[model samples]
Target: MSSAAAAVSAKPANSRSRVLLASLVGTTIEFYDFYVYATAAVLVFPHLFFPTGNETTALLSSFAVFGAAMVARPLGAVFFGHLGDRMGRKTTLVAALLTMGIATFLIGLLPTYAVAGWLAPALLVILRLAQGFALGGEWSGAALVATENAPQGKRALFGTFPQLGAPIGFIIANGLFLIIAALLPSDDPSRPSLAFLDWGWRIPFLFSAVMVIIGLWVRLNLVESNAFEKTVKTGQVRKVPLVTAFQNNFRELVLGTFYMLATYVLFYLMTTFSLSYGRAAIDAAVPGLGYDYTTFVLMMIIGVVFFGIFTLVSGPWADRFGRRKTLIWVTLAIALFGLCWVPMLAEGLVGVMAWLIIGFTLMGLTFGPMGALLPELFPANVRYTGSGISYNVSSILGAALAPFVAVALWSAGDGSPFWVGVYLTAMAVITLIALLLGRETRDIDIEE
Candidate 1:
């Protein structure tokens, strides 16, 4: 090998750490920016963006707008996946993060329905679509970067760093919202409502600007993954990655979609439904639980901590035991946890806490190995497109409709939360079956 080529191939141990940190932190910020919008969609967007004549209509419309991002995600994945595979993962990720940050920052500045009529919602939808598109490209690039750079026999464990970003992002996103909400004066008819509407909400969204800058700085320093470099050296990069993924790895793509269903469903329930339920229940029964909004945020942060820990734990376990087995066990736990949702919801604060802890633990376990498992199932040439499409397609079927479906089910049953649990349970079962049917990819070679 040439001196330059040998130097590139002989990167020091610290290089991997630097690359992992860059990928993890960049993804965390991207997810944070993305999820902040999700939280707002559930809690505030209905009133701010779609203040129609009826409350139900407004809420439904907000969720509809939220779903718009999911719809755009697959498109983003295809476009960016192609770029990553054909161009380079680092280049694609930088572009994706910039797009997401700009969209989120703009969202903070948007005028509300109260101020701008239909134009407010129109602009919000456009921005939401932009957010989804950016996220679509972000996850696959980050995951591939982390996994591809990992040491042999440690791919699953190392991949967890990128996956860890999900929970960390959730923690930061919810924690920021919680802090801002707590600082807002209690909802008083006498006091100016502008405190929250005019400014408080914008704080969380505008915070993305700082995160985006940090992400850009970190991402700019990252080298292209060694695996991608190897692919380039072998002249194996595909000219049409999306088509190649579909043609060669269709089964893995389909299975990946199913594999992600349960986690996605659980995520929406824990973050969106649980928040709304906890807030409403607290408002009605236990005022001393602190502000309903604040309590919900704290609980979410608690869940986020467990989520990160469990994800880290799942990494080595998956590498040892196999991704399929780990996934099946986690899916079963999620299914069982779903069955406890109604009982837990009825038990007040303690019940909610137990529910979140259990749910997030399961989330961590299932989510941790997925980053490596999905990519391992496909060949390197199609890895980016295959994994990207599968992940976002699952997001559409599982997460995109979760809040909306959960709410509809809740309304259909006269306020009973049981139906929401049933929906989650069913999705978990789908994931369980998919994992059972899929081959274990734990030992798959990256360059295969």
Candidate 2:
């Protein structure tokens, strides 16, 4: 090959690595903020933001606030997806990181219900919406950045890099909270009160400032995505990417959204519901060894490490087996695992460990393929809008209602957690069917 041709090819490969790195770091921080709020919703928000109710009611209210973020996600997706397609990917990603960072940092400063009454929960909901909107833009932009810049024949593998950010972010968020909880003095008769509510809970939210600065610096250095650049050169950028996406890619959007159901439902079941179940079981004198709240946090961190490893593994497997095939098998596995929830949870600490390890492994496999699968289903022109809308909409349907539904089911069942397992299993079955019906896009030429 001529030197000019060789140099041209080399440039994009080098740029792709940088793009992947930038997207990975920024996405990790964004999700760190997002998951930090989720963890707080379970452990702290019920006490701090909605302190007026009984335990169950306060927990339900906390999850309701959590759902508010999911509700705003689709709106954020539509707004940012338009800008990303028309203006550029780099610009949208940078803006998303800043929006999430500022909102999360400010959450640390908000007054409790004791000080602000109804206004405290009201303000929390508004900030939660801002966080949701920022995250709505985050995934699609990061996925496009990785996929667009990837080397030929390796898009699936490269695409998983950004997906890796989710578990890493989860670990960082949960790990920080666990550390803080550990440092506080126990409230048992033998120990002094550590005053967790007075100060400890705020530390994790406050630390978001450090991550935000680092994420912004990395994102600012990234160049616009090559797919978007090609759109500009060809004068094919959509004036209303969301409209165009709906007009041309509605079928794929529906399928992608449903295909994500199992993952989202399983996500909340494993993370949020497990925390509540573990704590309640411990307090109720269940037969098996019980875990304190902090123990559950530590278990989740362990699950995240496995989550990252499986995500890495799934990318190469998807490239070899095709996205649809890989996803179908993973979805089926999740459905089957959901059935084991009650039995496992009943077994105490050992059962919980087994449950998390198995559940998170499946989560990794399915999540890895999704980064490539959803975007590849659409043509490059509307990829940002199509993938962004489908993803965030799925978050609303699957994740937003998960905690609320699980709690209601548990209550109606007279403290039986088996009903929660059935709910998650149903979502997995839907995802399995959706994956079976979807096309395999692993070999589709990206520029098409």
Candidate 3:
């Protein structure tokens, strides 16, 4: 075939629906696997894997392991980002999905500390690392898949398809756990049932296999996006995307990593830390709101509904107002929101629910544009590596430490969440500074 004919032939036959579905499903599965582990880190791991005798110590240990995964994420970014930038997004995305699925499924089968001793937590840490690694690559690829195939002026809007996965995944993962706990009711409503602690928690991890299969089916049907195809045809594919990313786009790398800082911290705080805080008995050494496990998860699910809504809503706003400008306003709101945590959570159920709703709403707004903005920061030659590294490294700085730090701050405040709110505001301020230093990415020609 002639060069022109080959170019025409290489145009993806994938419909818009297929592109959106493939991107959305892959991330849904990825985040579902992640949120399952996050929920388990709060609900089960402290009891099963880390028996430190003290409640606070055990929970801290579980969170430490959870945070360890964040350390592996940047490494995953380098490895899989290389594959994606050089090999193509389709195969790399499939590999990432498979990796995360296998790790999550294996987590369900692992023996608890009571059965296997120290080796149990050791193995859990390894598998958690694998999950983090896989996810490091997953988001960038999904974001690329969505934005690259978007029609003119719609990249930001299309990008939200993948961003939507966070709330969707959170709902499914937490909702399933709530259902399982409800079915296996213990005499006390506040704590997890014995059955749930023993086996029900594993169900969510094992269920990942089913979702992975569906994600694989959708992603396997995808063709490379035209933006990436153009790079391939032009012979612009980098031999070492990671190195090239740093060499050519060092500023974007720094900016992108910090840009996501507030989102990471707020999300973990809302889901993991809040679950631990909301459910602890009011008279405990570290007092909490004293809600039951099921009730708190339900509240989080309700809050996540706003997360999903605002995620989609932010997309159109980003497309219309410019990604940077919209995100600047959202980040500022997140900063202000952080200051209100004390008053909000102190008000009882009405106050706590309002706090959750508002926090997650801001999470959606801040997180939505990143699907396009990060990828748009770099040209196609190293976009996968650049964005993946930035996103995951921020996971280490922001998410990996958020819960652990919040727990410490909560203890320091003598059960008050004031210090935790301060920590969040500090992170938000960092994100805001980064945003100010960065350029608007809404109009960037990603194909270049």
Model 1 over residues 26-61: C-alpha lDDT tens digits?
889888987898788867787678878665577778
The local lDDT score (0 to 100) that residue 157 gets in candidate 2 is: 86
- What's the true lDDT of residue 237 in model 3? 80
Question: Worst ten-residue run, lDDT, model 3?
Answer: 1-10
Q: Scored by CA lDDT, what does every candidate get?
A: 0.82, 0.82, 0.92
Residues 337-362 of candidate 2: C-alpha lDDT, one tens digit per residue: 87888898677668888888888898
lDDT of each residue in 1-448, candidate 3, tens digit only: 1463365356656789999999899999999999999999988898899988899999999999999999999999999999998888989999999999999999999999999999999999999999999999999999999998999999998999999999999999988988888788888865578999898999999999999999999998898888777787787887899888988899999999999999999999998999999998999999988988878888989999999999999999999999999989999999999899998887888999999999999989998999999999999989999999999999999999999999999998889999999899999999999999999988878899
Over the full model, what C-alpha lDDT does candidate 1 score relative to the true structure?
0.82
Q: Per the 3 Å backbone cut-off, how many clashing residue pairs does candidate 2 have?
A: 0
Candidate 1: list runs displaced more than 4 Å.
1-14, 188-193, 281-291
Off by over 4 Å in 3: 1-11
RMSD of each: 3.1, 3.9, 1.8
Task: Work out the TM-score per prediction.
Answer: 0.93, 0.94, 0.98
**Candidate 1, poorest ten consecutive residues by summed lDDT:** 282-291
Best by lDDT: 3
